[model samples]
Target: VTITDDSEDDCQYEEVAADDEFSIQEGDEDLPKALQTIQEHAEDAQILASQSVLLSEKSVSEVPEAVDDFLCNFLVRLGMSRTLDCFQTEWYELIQRGVLSAKDTGLVPSVYTRNQELEMENMHLKKDLENYKLAANKAKEALLKMQKERDFHRMHHKRVVQEKSRLICDIKRLKTHYASYEPVLKHLTEKYQTTLRQKMLTNLERDRAVGQITGLQAALQNLESG
Candidate 1:
């Protein structure tokens, strides 16, 4: 009974492990989702930058140093700082504009910060996704291994059952043969006893006949003498 329970529990445990693996797979799927979100935002930023080229040129002069630093950092982080030649060239002119307010300059820095934050988040999520996928694969492999082992056990179980049945059938046949021969064996014993009794009786009769013949011969001799 304990063995039966253990076997059932092992099967259940394997199933649970497989389910855990699937859960990890689902978790990994979210990793790509976060990356996709970041990519979409990056694309949006690229589109905004392309459409607002003049805005970049105009803000370069009037934008605060903090905003300027933000743009520089953003470009550096994105590996595009060296390619900002036109933005750099127009910086002097925009500084001389003296028309746009500081508030108007804040937008670019905010966008850059937001992009950086999104990128970092996406990278973190990607790492998590990789871990999840690894776990899922490991669990799936274990499940497959368990299934193979279970199948082997099942086959062995079937063989054992078949062997047990065969043994039981053999035992029954032997028992039947033994039972069928019991009466015959008994009859043989009885016949042997009867034959021994008949032999003893015949020997006794022969001895008596010999003794009577001897006595008669002796009497005949006595008469001749007289």
Candidate 2:
């Protein structure tokens, strides 16, 4: 009877080991299903990320044209509105609006999607901040360049004024030297004085006639020559 008890105990031990082995194999069978679920989830997440990025990049003016797209379509199908009449402020307000009830599209997986969205938004904000910093730096550099150009122009204007004053002084000295020759040159001048005076008067009258016409025309001609 003692030998019989020992034999029974040995059989029970072997059976327990065999059951453990079976259990391990059965657990392995569930792995494929879990992996497949994960894969499907990852694919959905990728699609959602792509869509979110596209939506974020779209201009305010461009949003209405995509009225039949995912979020809009979903809202419309839910009997929210017929037209995509919501503007910029209304759009953001809607995102912040809490749902009293929502579609039970698998709560666990929907939470995962929401997590992915939050991570995506964080990444987008970081990138946007970087872009804004870069733009601000560029504007500063451009402003500095403009200021330098303005300073250079101011200095050049001062130099031009000084040079103009010197040229005028030289012209005055030359006119003084020519004044002595004016009397001796009268014999040659008298030969055609009457004709020259008549020509000068005619030119003056022509100029006065042109001045009486249109001031705008004269201004336009001055601009074109410059």
Candidate 3:
């Protein structure tokens, strides 16, 4: 029994060695690719870590400007000497009395300053709105005046057109009235010419008749003498 067990154990050890050799050969082919991937990841981590530190330093440098310093700067910039003096007196008094602490005296948040800016902008916009309204009212009045003038001119033009129409009608009527008299004037001229010719013929016939009567009387006188 001991000899058979020893032989089985020897066969198992040889099979384990063969499996280990196969695994090593397969992993050796991909070792360089795995190392390159790990190297790229390490470089990316270093860049990210450096950028994070820069951003952290910048943010910290911007956050804690101390509320009192901000107020002093604001008052000085606005030229408020009396108000700044009063504020400093009160603020230092409170600080010496231990009524304020570092925790209570943080920087003024961006939200508050942004709100003040919005309020000032709103006031300016309201002023501009009022000015625009006044300008609009004046423009509306001017437009109304122009419209009134246009209406008056339109009415005047209509009256002038009516007057022209009436004048044209009167001219046409005068022409028709003159046309009625033209035929009567022509007939009167013909009658006057006929009367003048008859008068001339009657005068000639009377002269000839007078000459004949006188000759007959002379002829009778001659007969009596013979």
Arrange candidates by lDDT, descending. Answer: 3, 1, 2
Residues 204-226 of candidate 3: C-alpha lDDT, one tens digit per residue:
88888888988988999999998
Clashes of 1: 2
- Candidate that beats the other on TM-score, 2 or 3, i.e. the better one: 3
lDDT per residue, candidate 2, 1-226, as tens digits?
A: 0011232342222223524322333455688776776676668768968986775455332322222244454455456674555633465465467432233211233354456458668889999999999999999999999999999999999999999999999999999999978987996788689889999999999999888777878888999999
lDDT of 2 at 75: 57
- TM-score of every candidate: 0.54, 0.29, 0.50
lDDT of 1 by residue, 1-226 (tens): 0011232342222223524323333346688766776676668768867867875455544433455556566577678855565565566467678554666444454455667679889989999999999999999999999999999999999999999999999999999999999999999999999999999999999999999999999999999999
Regions of candidate 2 where Cα sits further than 4 Å from its true position:
1-116, 177-226
As for TM-score, the candidate ahead, 1 or 2, is 1
Q: Model 2 reaches what TM-score against the true structure?
A: 0.29
**Alpha-carbon RMSD, candidate 2:** 33.5
- Which parts of model 1 are misplaced by more than 4 Å? 1-108, 224-226
lDDT against the true structure, per candidate, is 0.71, 0.64, 0.76
